[model samples]
Target: MPPEDEPKVEIKLCSENDLVLLNKAIPEPGYHERRFASQQDGKASYLLAWQNGVPVGHLLIKWEGSGPQVNKYLPDTPELNAIGVWPPKNRSKGIGGQLIEKAEGMAKEKGFKQVALAVEIDNSRAKELYEKLGYMDWGHGEYIDEWVEKGDDGEETQHKDPCYYLVKNLE
Candidate 1:
Protein backbone atom coordinates (compact mmCIF):
# COMPACT_ATOMS: atom_id res chain seq x y z
CA MET A 1 0.00 0.00 0.00
CA PRO A 2 3.06 2.23 -0.02
CA PRO A 3 4.71 3.89 -3.00
CA GLU A 4 7.52 1.99 -4.66
CA ASP A 5 10.05 4.69 -3.99
CA GLU A 6 9.28 5.02 -0.30
CA PRO A 7 12.27 4.12 1.82
CA LYS A 8 11.85 1.11 4.04
CA VAL A 9 11.90 1.99 7.73
CA GLU A 10 13.20 -0.34 10.42
CA ILE A 11 12.65 0.14 14.14
CA LYS A 12 15.04 -1.23 16.73
CA LEU A 13 16.09 -0.78 20.37
CA CYS A 14 18.90 1.75 20.70
CA SER A 15 22.37 0.39 21.38
CA GLU A 16 25.21 2.41 22.89
CA ASN A 17 26.87 2.92 19.50
CA ASP A 18 23.50 3.64 17.95
CA LEU A 19 22.97 6.28 20.58
CA VAL A 20 26.25 7.90 19.53
CA LEU A 21 25.19 7.64 15.89
CA LEU A 22 21.85 9.30 16.52
CA ASN A 23 23.49 12.03 18.58
CA LYS A 24 25.86 12.72 15.71
CA ALA A 25 22.98 12.93 13.27
CA ILE A 26 20.69 15.07 15.41
CA PRO A 27 23.20 16.81 17.66
CA GLU A 28 21.18 16.30 20.85
CA PRO A 29 24.45 16.26 22.80
CA GLY A 30 23.87 14.72 26.25
CA TYR A 31 20.20 13.89 25.80
CA HIS A 32 20.83 10.56 24.14
CA GLU A 33 23.41 9.56 26.72
CA ARG A 34 21.02 10.27 29.55
CA ARG A 35 18.26 8.25 27.91
CA PHE A 36 20.73 5.48 27.20
CA ALA A 37 21.67 5.35 30.85
CA SER A 38 18.04 5.09 31.80
CA GLN A 39 17.68 2.23 29.37
CA GLN A 40 20.70 0.53 30.88
CA ASP A 41 19.18 0.90 34.31
CA GLY A 42 15.91 -0.75 33.20
CA LYS A 43 14.04 2.46 33.80
CA ALA A 44 13.31 3.11 30.11
CA SER A 45 13.70 1.93 26.57
CA TYR A 46 15.01 4.05 23.71
CA LEU A 47 13.84 3.11 20.25
CA LEU A 48 15.27 4.38 16.99
CA ALA A 49 13.89 4.28 13.48
CA TRP A 50 16.37 3.65 10.69
CA GLN A 51 16.04 4.47 7.03
CA ASN A 52 18.72 3.09 4.77
CA GLY A 53 20.87 2.46 7.83
CA VAL A 54 20.54 6.10 8.98
CA PRO A 55 18.77 7.00 12.21
CA VAL A 56 15.72 9.08 11.38
CA GLY A 57 13.45 9.00 14.42
CA HIS A 58 13.38 8.11 18.13
CA LEU A 59 10.98 7.36 20.99
CA LEU A 60 11.49 6.88 24.72
CA ILE A 61 9.27 4.68 26.86
CA LYS A 62 9.56 5.33 30.56
CA TRP A 63 8.66 2.33 32.67
CA GLU A 64 7.16 4.58 35.29
CA GLY A 65 5.66 8.01 35.49
CA SER A 66 8.00 11.00 35.97
CA GLY A 67 5.46 13.64 37.00
CA PRO A 68 3.31 14.17 40.03
CA GLN A 69 0.00 13.94 38.18
CA VAL A 70 1.03 10.90 36.23
CA ASN A 71 2.38 9.27 39.36
CA LYS A 72 -0.78 10.04 41.24
CA TYR A 73 -3.16 8.93 38.50
CA LEU A 74 -1.57 6.62 35.96
CA PRO A 75 0.96 5.11 38.29
CA ASP A 76 1.40 1.80 36.48
CA THR A 77 1.11 3.15 32.97
CA PRO A 78 4.30 3.41 30.96
CA GLU A 79 4.83 6.82 29.41
CA LEU A 80 5.87 7.44 25.84
CA ASN A 81 8.19 10.43 25.91
CA ALA A 82 10.06 12.46 23.34
CA ILE A 83 8.72 10.83 20.20
CA GLY A 84 10.16 12.55 17.13
CA VAL A 85 11.15 12.25 13.50
CA TRP A 86 14.15 14.28 12.42
CA PRO A 87 15.76 16.07 9.43
CA PRO A 88 12.56 18.12 8.82
CA LYS A 89 12.08 16.13 5.63
CA ASN A 90 10.89 13.05 7.50
CA ARG A 91 7.77 14.67 8.82
CA SER A 92 4.58 12.78 7.95
CA LYS A 93 5.32 9.86 5.64
CA GLY A 94 4.01 7.67 8.57
CA ILE A 95 7.39 7.39 10.30
CA GLY A 96 6.17 8.95 13.52
CA GLY A 97 3.06 6.81 13.52
CA GLN A 98 5.12 3.69 12.96
CA LEU A 99 7.28 4.49 15.94
CA ILE A 100 4.18 4.94 18.07
CA GLU A 101 2.66 1.72 16.89
CA LYS A 102 5.84 -0.08 17.80
CA ALA A 103 5.75 1.48 21.25
CA GLU A 104 2.18 0.41 21.75
CA GLY A 105 3.04 -3.14 20.81
CA MET A 106 5.93 -3.16 23.21
CA ALA A 107 3.71 -1.98 26.02
CA LYS A 108 1.17 -4.66 25.24
CA GLU A 109 3.92 -7.27 25.29
CA LYS A 110 4.96 -6.06 28.72
CA GLY A 111 1.41 -6.76 29.96
CA PHE A 112 0.43 -3.15 30.36
CA LYS A 113 -3.21 -2.47 29.62
CA GLN A 114 -2.70 1.23 29.03
CA VAL A 115 -0.07 3.71 27.83
CA ALA A 116 0.20 7.43 28.44
CA LEU A 117 2.00 10.44 26.96
CA ALA A 118 1.93 14.18 27.30
CA VAL A 119 1.66 16.65 24.46
CA GLU A 120 2.45 20.33 24.56
CA ILE A 121 -0.86 22.19 24.64
CA ASP A 122 -0.16 23.70 21.21
CA ASN A 123 1.03 20.57 19.46
CA SER A 124 -2.15 19.94 17.53
CA ARG A 125 -0.36 18.03 14.79
CA ALA A 126 0.86 15.43 17.27
CA LYS A 127 -2.43 15.39 19.16
CA GLU A 128 -4.25 14.70 15.92
CA LEU A 129 -1.87 11.89 15.07
CA TYR A 130 -2.30 10.38 18.53
CA GLU A 131 -6.05 10.60 18.27
CA LYS A 132 -5.90 8.84 14.93
CA LEU A 133 -4.02 6.05 16.69
CA GLY A 134 -6.66 5.91 19.49
CA TYR A 135 -5.16 8.15 22.19
CA MET A 136 -7.58 10.38 24.05
CA ASP A 137 -7.24 13.41 26.24
CA TRP A 138 -6.62 12.30 29.80
CA GLY A 139 -8.98 15.01 31.14
CA HIS A 140 -6.61 15.85 33.95
CA GLY A 141 -5.49 19.48 33.95
CA GLU A 142 -2.17 20.63 32.53
CA TYR A 143 1.20 19.98 34.15
CA ILE A 144 4.59 21.54 33.72
CA ASP A 145 6.75 19.58 31.33
CA GLU A 146 10.33 19.71 32.56
CA TRP A 147 13.72 19.04 31.02
CA VAL A 148 17.31 20.24 31.22
CA GLU A 149 19.32 21.88 28.47
CA LYS A 150 23.09 21.94 28.60
CA GLY A 151 24.67 25.05 27.11
CA ASP A 152 27.92 25.55 25.26
CA ASP A 153 29.33 26.90 28.53
CA GLY A 154 28.77 23.45 30.05
CA GLU A 155 26.00 24.75 32.23
CA GLU A 156 22.64 23.01 32.47
CA THR A 157 19.47 25.05 32.39
CA GLN A 158 16.04 23.76 33.27
CA HIS A 159 13.25 24.23 30.77
CA LYS A 160 9.55 23.80 31.30
CA ASP A 161 6.44 23.80 29.11
CA PRO A 162 2.73 23.49 29.72
CA CYS A 163 1.40 20.09 28.65
CA TYR A 164 -1.49 17.73 29.28
CA TYR A 165 -1.52 13.99 29.29
CA LEU A 166 -3.23 11.58 26.90
CA VAL A 167 -3.98 7.91 27.34
CA LYS A 168 -4.76 4.88 25.19
CA ASN A 169 -6.00 1.46 26.21
CA LEU A 170 -4.15 -1.49 24.73
CA GLU A 171 -6.89 -3.94 25.55
Candidate 2:
Protein backbone atom coordinates (compact mmCIF):
# COMPACT_ATOMS: atom_id res chain seq x y z
CA MET A 1 0.00 0.00 0.00
CA PRO A 2 1.15 3.54 -0.73
CA PRO A 3 1.78 6.04 2.01
CA GLU A 4 -0.81 8.60 3.04
CA ASP A 5 0.54 11.30 0.74
CA GLU A 6 0.81 9.07 -2.33
CA PRO A 7 -2.22 8.80 -4.52
CA LYS A 8 -3.50 5.42 -5.69
CA VAL A 9 -3.05 4.67 -9.37
CA GLU A 10 -3.92 2.00 -11.94
CA ILE A 11 -1.27 0.79 -14.31
CA LYS A 12 -2.21 -0.71 -17.65
CA LEU A 13 -1.13 -0.96 -21.28
CA CYS A 14 -2.16 2.11 -23.25
CA SER A 15 -4.78 1.32 -25.81
CA GLU A 16 -5.22 3.03 -29.17
CA ASN A 17 -7.69 5.33 -27.50
CA ASP A 18 -5.33 6.13 -24.66
CA LEU A 19 -2.73 7.38 -27.12
CA VAL A 20 -4.74 10.53 -27.75
CA LEU A 21 -5.12 11.12 -24.04
CA LEU A 22 -1.43 10.54 -23.42
CA ASN A 23 -0.48 13.05 -26.08
CA LYS A 24 -2.46 15.67 -24.25
CA ALA A 25 -1.26 14.82 -20.75
CA ILE A 26 2.46 14.37 -21.34
CA PRO A 27 4.40 17.66 -21.43
CA GLU A 28 7.58 16.25 -22.93
CA PRO A 29 7.86 17.01 -26.60
CA GLY A 30 8.07 14.10 -29.08
CA TYR A 31 7.02 11.55 -26.48
CA HIS A 32 3.60 11.01 -27.98
CA GLU A 33 4.93 10.91 -31.51
CA ARG A 34 7.55 8.30 -30.74
CA ARG A 35 5.26 6.07 -28.71
CA PHE A 36 2.52 6.38 -31.26
CA ALA A 37 4.83 5.32 -34.05
CA SER A 38 6.03 2.32 -32.04
CA GLN A 39 2.50 1.34 -31.24
CA GLN A 40 1.43 1.58 -34.87
CA ASP A 41 4.30 -0.69 -35.88
CA GLY A 42 3.57 -3.11 -33.03
CA LYS A 43 7.23 -2.91 -31.98
CA ALA A 44 6.61 -1.52 -28.50
CA SER A 45 4.14 -1.41 -25.62
CA TYR A 46 3.37 1.79 -23.71
CA LEU A 47 2.10 1.52 -20.16
CA LEU A 48 0.52 4.43 -18.31
CA ALA A 49 -0.25 4.87 -14.63
CA TRP A 50 -3.42 6.82 -13.98
CA GLN A 51 -4.53 8.54 -10.80
CA ASN A 52 -7.97 10.05 -10.63
CA GLY A 53 -8.26 9.79 -14.45
CA VAL A 54 -5.00 11.66 -15.01
CA PRO A 55 -1.74 10.16 -16.24
CA VAL A 56 0.86 10.20 -13.50
CA GLY A 57 3.61 8.12 -15.17
CA HIS A 58 4.51 6.14 -18.26
CA LEU A 59 7.00 3.46 -19.40
CA LEU A 60 7.84 1.89 -22.73
CA ILE A 61 8.67 -1.79 -23.28
CA LYS A 62 10.44 -2.19 -26.57
CA TRP A 63 10.64 -5.69 -27.97
CA GLU A 64 14.02 -7.43 -28.26
CA GLY A 65 14.24 -6.73 -31.97
CA SER A 66 14.00 -2.98 -31.36
CA GLY A 67 16.81 -2.43 -28.83
CA PRO A 68 20.44 -3.17 -29.77
CA GLN A 69 21.53 -3.74 -26.17
CA VAL A 70 18.71 -6.10 -25.41
CA ASN A 71 19.66 -8.12 -28.48
CA LYS A 72 23.22 -8.41 -27.22
CA TYR A 73 22.72 -9.22 -23.52
CA LEU A 74 19.37 -10.97 -23.43
CA PRO A 75 18.24 -11.53 -26.99
CA ASP A 76 14.84 -12.75 -25.85
CA THR A 77 14.26 -10.00 -23.34
CA PRO A 78 12.26 -6.86 -23.84
CA GLU A 79 13.82 -3.48 -23.08
CA LEU A 80 12.05 -1.28 -20.62
CA ASN A 81 12.83 2.23 -21.79
CA ALA A 82 11.59 5.85 -21.74
CA ILE A 83 10.19 5.85 -18.23
CA GLY A 84 8.92 9.13 -16.76
CA VAL A 85 6.59 10.71 -14.25
CA TRP A 86 4.66 13.87 -15.01
CA PRO A 87 4.12 17.11 -13.03
CA PRO A 88 7.59 16.76 -11.45
CA LYS A 89 5.82 17.05 -8.12
CA ASN A 90 4.41 13.55 -8.57
CA ARG A 91 7.86 11.95 -8.36
CA SER A 92 9.22 9.79 -5.51
CA LYS A 93 5.73 8.75 -4.57
CA GLY A 94 6.23 5.21 -5.89
CA ILE A 95 4.81 6.00 -9.34
CA GLY A 96 8.06 5.20 -11.09
CA GLY A 97 8.39 1.92 -9.20
CA GLN A 98 4.86 0.99 -10.18
CA LEU A 99 5.65 1.68 -13.82
CA ILE A 100 8.65 -0.63 -13.67
CA GLU A 101 6.58 -3.38 -12.11
CA LYS A 102 3.98 -3.00 -14.82
CA ALA A 103 6.66 -3.29 -17.50
CA GLU A 104 7.97 -6.50 -15.93
CA GLY A 105 4.49 -7.96 -15.84
CA MET A 106 4.02 -7.19 -19.54
CA ALA A 107 7.34 -8.78 -20.43
CA LYS A 108 6.45 -11.91 -18.45
CA GLU A 109 3.13 -12.15 -20.22
CA LYS A 110 4.99 -12.02 -23.55
CA GLY A 111 7.17 -14.99 -22.47
CA PHE A 112 10.32 -12.99 -21.84
CA LYS A 113 12.57 -14.35 -19.11
CA GLN A 114 14.36 -11.09 -18.45
CA VAL A 115 14.23 -7.35 -19.09
CA ALA A 116 16.93 -4.85 -20.03
CA LEU A 117 17.42 -1.06 -20.12
CA ALA A 118 20.05 1.64 -20.48
CA VAL A 119 20.79 4.57 -18.20
CA GLU A 120 22.98 7.58 -18.79
CA ILE A 121 26.24 7.24 -16.85
CA ASP A 122 25.63 10.48 -14.96
CA ASN A 123 21.97 9.93 -14.12
CA SER A 124 22.35 8.87 -10.50
CA ARG A 125 18.72 9.40 -9.64
CA ALA A 126 17.39 7.15 -12.42
CA LYS A 127 20.12 4.59 -11.77
CA GLU A 128 19.13 4.46 -8.12
CA LEU A 129 15.49 4.00 -9.00
CA TYR A 130 16.26 1.09 -11.34
CA GLU A 131 18.48 -0.54 -8.74
CA LYS A 132 15.79 -0.27 -6.11
CA LEU A 133 13.42 -1.98 -8.53
CA GLY A 134 15.76 -5.00 -8.98
CA TYR A 135 17.62 -3.91 -12.14
CA MET A 136 21.37 -4.36 -11.93
CA ASP A 137 24.38 -3.23 -13.88
CA TRP A 138 25.05 -6.41 -15.82
CA GLY A 139 28.05 -4.86 -17.54
CA HIS A 140 29.53 -1.63 -18.77
CA GLY A 141 28.97 -0.80 -22.43
CA GLU A 142 28.12 2.23 -24.52
CA TYR A 143 24.93 2.62 -26.54
CA ILE A 144 24.07 5.31 -29.08
CA ASP A 145 20.52 6.28 -28.33
CA GLU A 146 18.83 7.95 -31.29
CA TRP A 147 15.50 9.53 -32.03
CA VAL A 148 13.96 11.76 -34.73
CA GLU A 149 11.31 14.39 -34.33
CA LYS A 150 9.55 16.72 -36.69
CA GLY A 151 9.62 20.48 -36.36
CA ASP A 152 6.61 22.72 -36.71
CA ASP A 153 7.74 23.46 -40.27
CA GLY A 154 7.72 19.72 -41.08
CA GLU A 155 11.51 19.36 -40.91
CA GLU A 156 12.89 16.36 -39.04
CA THR A 157 15.45 16.64 -36.25
CA GLN A 158 17.54 13.75 -34.99
CA HIS A 159 19.05 13.42 -31.53
CA LYS A 160 21.46 10.95 -29.95
CA ASP A 161 22.94 10.18 -26.55
CA PRO A 162 25.35 7.59 -25.15
CA CYS A 163 24.33 5.41 -22.20
CA TYR A 164 25.32 2.36 -20.12
CA TYR A 165 23.36 -0.87 -20.15
CA LEU A 166 21.54 -2.65 -17.31
CA VAL A 167 19.50 -5.84 -17.06
CA LYS A 168 17.25 -7.75 -14.68
CA ASN A 169 16.24 -11.40 -14.61
CA LEU A 170 12.48 -11.75 -14.34
CA GLU A 171 12.58 -15.25 -12.96
- In the order shown, what is each candidate's alpha-carbon RMSD? 1.8, 2.3
Per-candidate local distance difference test: 0.87, 0.79
Q: Which clashing pairs does model 2 show?
A: none
What's the TM-score of each model vs. the native?
0.93, 0.86
lDDT of 1 by residue, 13-84 (tens): 999888667977877768788888999999999999999888999999998866675788777799999899
Highest-scoring model, TM-score: 1
Which ranges of candidate 2 are over 4 A from the true structure?
1-5, 28-30
lDDT of 2 by residue, 1-171 (tens): 355766798998777777667767886566666786786788998888999888878888888543564466557877788889998989888898888988898788888888888788788899888887788876755776676768767788898877777788888
